[model samples]
Target: MNENMNTSTIRGPLDHEIRDQIISAATEHFSHYGYEKTTVSDLAKAIGFSKAYIYKFFESKQAIGAVICTNRLAMIMEIVDAAIAGAPTASEKLRCLFRSISEAGSDLFFHDRKLYDIAAVASRDQWPSAVAHQVRIRAIIQQILLDGRASGEFERKTPLDEATKAIFLIILPYVNPAQLQYNLDTAPEAAVHLPALILRSLAP
Candidate 1:
C-alpha cells in the first residue's frame, strides 16, 4: 500500500485526522520534492482529496509548507523548554536552552537535511507563520533575560527588550540553522565557545 494512501474517510467533515493527513502528506512531498515544486494538486492526490478540497484546509501550498516549518519550530521550543525545566538559575536556563538549541540544530543538519532545508527556505521566504515563530523565539529569550534579572544573575544596564535583542543578535548563528552550519564549518572553535562568551557578557 502507498504510505500516504488513507483508508479512513477523507470526505464530509474534514476532521483533525484528515487535516493531519493532508499536512503529513504535504510535509513528505515538500521534503522529497521541494516546496516550489510541490503543488496543492500533488498534495490532494496524495491525500485522496480534490485540489479544491485541499485549499479548503490550507490557503496555499506555501501555507502548508509554512505550517510545517512552524511545527518544526514548535518542536525545537520543546527541547528548549525541557532544557530550562531543571536548570538551577535563569543564567543556567538560558545557557541550557542555548546549548540545547544548538545541539538540536546540529542534529537536524546532520541527520535531517531535508527538514533543515525546508526551514532554511521558510526563513528565506519569510512566510508569515515562520516569521511569527521567530518573533515568539525572541520573546522566549526576553523572558529568560527577565528571569536572570530577577535572580541578579545578569546585569541589565539596558532595557530588557534591548538586552534581548542584543543577545539574540550575538547568538543568531547558534539559533539559525544556516548560520550555525556556516559558523561550525568556518570557525569550529568560536562556534563551540560562542554561547559561553555570550553568557559571560550578560553576567553581573
Candidate 2:
C-alpha cells in the first residue's frame, strides 16, 4: 500500500487490450469475492492467466482495485452530471446533484455491497482515485454556485471557495463510502431537506 510507488514503472508499457481484460476479470472477481479477501493469484486463476502475467500489467492487487474503484466512481459522476444538465435552474441543479449522489450511494450500498467495501477502503486509505473524485465533485459544486450567482438566484457575498467546501461537506456523508451506511436511514429525508436549506441560504 505504498501510495508513492510508481506502479507503472514496475510494469513498463502495458498492452491495453490485455490490461483491460485483466481489469474486467478483476472487477468481476472483486464484485463477487470482495476486494480484501481476494488476491492477485485468485484473480489470475479465475481469469485463466498466470499470476506473473497479471503482475506484468498491474504491480499489485491494489492497483487493480484502484482501477475498479475509479470506474465505479466515474459511473456515479456520470449520473450526477446528467442530472445537473437536465435541471432547468441552478437551484434545481444543486438539488439534482444532492439527490443523484444520495440515490446512487444508497444503490451501491444495498445492491452492490461488495463493491461498496472496496470504495470504503479507497476512501479510508485516501487512494488517488478517491482524492481525485472529491476534487471533481468540489469543482462541480463551485460551478453550480457560480451559475447561481450569475443568475442572481444566489447571494454573492460569500467567498466561492469557502461556499464550495462547505456545500461539499454537507453532502459528504451521502457520498463517503465509509460514512454512508451510518447515515442511510436518514438519507432520503436529508436529501430533500438539505438542498432546500442550502437553496434558501443562497437566495439573494
Candidate 3:
C-alpha cells in the first residue's frame, strides 16, 4: 500500500466512533490471532460487519495493520519521552533513551510476541509507520546531542547531524524490530555499556 495516499481519497468519512470500534476490534483480533493469519474478512466477521463495510474505513489489510503499528510505535516513544524527561542532564537523558528503547523492545518481544511479529513485518516491508517512528527517534537523539553540546557536556567538534546519525545507528539493533530479536541476548549489557562508550566519545 502507498502509505502517503490520503485516507479521504480512498476511504469513507472517518466517523470517530466507528473507527475506534473497528480499531479496537482489530487490535484484539490481531493480538490473539496474529497479523498475517487474520484477514479483513475475519475482522469483519469478528466485528459483525460486512467485508465491504470494513473496506470503507481501511483500503487494505495492510492499511489496518499500519494503524496498529503506528499506535504501538507511538506508545514506545511516549515511554522514551518520559524517561528523557525524568533525567536531569542531556548525557543522562541519552542514556535513559538507550536503556528505555532496549527495555521497551524486550517487553514487546517477551510479553507481546504477536504484536512484535507485526512490527517485524512492518520494519522489513519499510512501512510508513516504521519509517516515521525511526525519524522521530532520530530527532529526539539529535535534540539530546544539541543540548549536550550547549551545556559543554559533549564535544562541539563533531557535526551535530553526523553525531545524531552515528548514535541512531548504534541504537538501531535495539530499535529496529526486524533486528531486535537477534541481539536480545546482548542488549542488556550493550544498553548499559554502549551509552557509556558513546558518552566518553562525546565528552568535551
RMSD values for the candidates in order, in angstroms, are 6.3, 1.7, 1.7
Clashing pairs in 3: none
How far is 136's C-alpha from truth in model 1 (Å)? 2.4
Give every collision pair in model 2: none
What's model 2's lDDT at 172?
92
What stretches of model 2 exceed 4 Å from their correct place? 2-15
> Local distance difference test, per candidate?
0.71, 0.88, 0.88
Q: What local lDDT score does residue 85 receive in model 1, on the 0 to 100 scale? A: 88
Error of 1 at 51 (Å): 2.2
Report the lDDT tens digits of candidate 3 across residue range 1-204: 445423543366666678778888988888889998988889899999999988878888888788888888888888999999999999999999999999998898898888888888899888878998899999999999989989989999998899999999999999999999899999999999999999999999
- Lowest summed lDDT across 10 adjacent residues in model 3 is found at 1-10
Write candidate 1's Cα lDDT for 58-170 as tens digits.
66666566667778878887887888887988877777766777777777767766777767776666655556766876887898888888888888797888888987787
| Pairwise TM-score winner, candidates 1 and 3 | 3
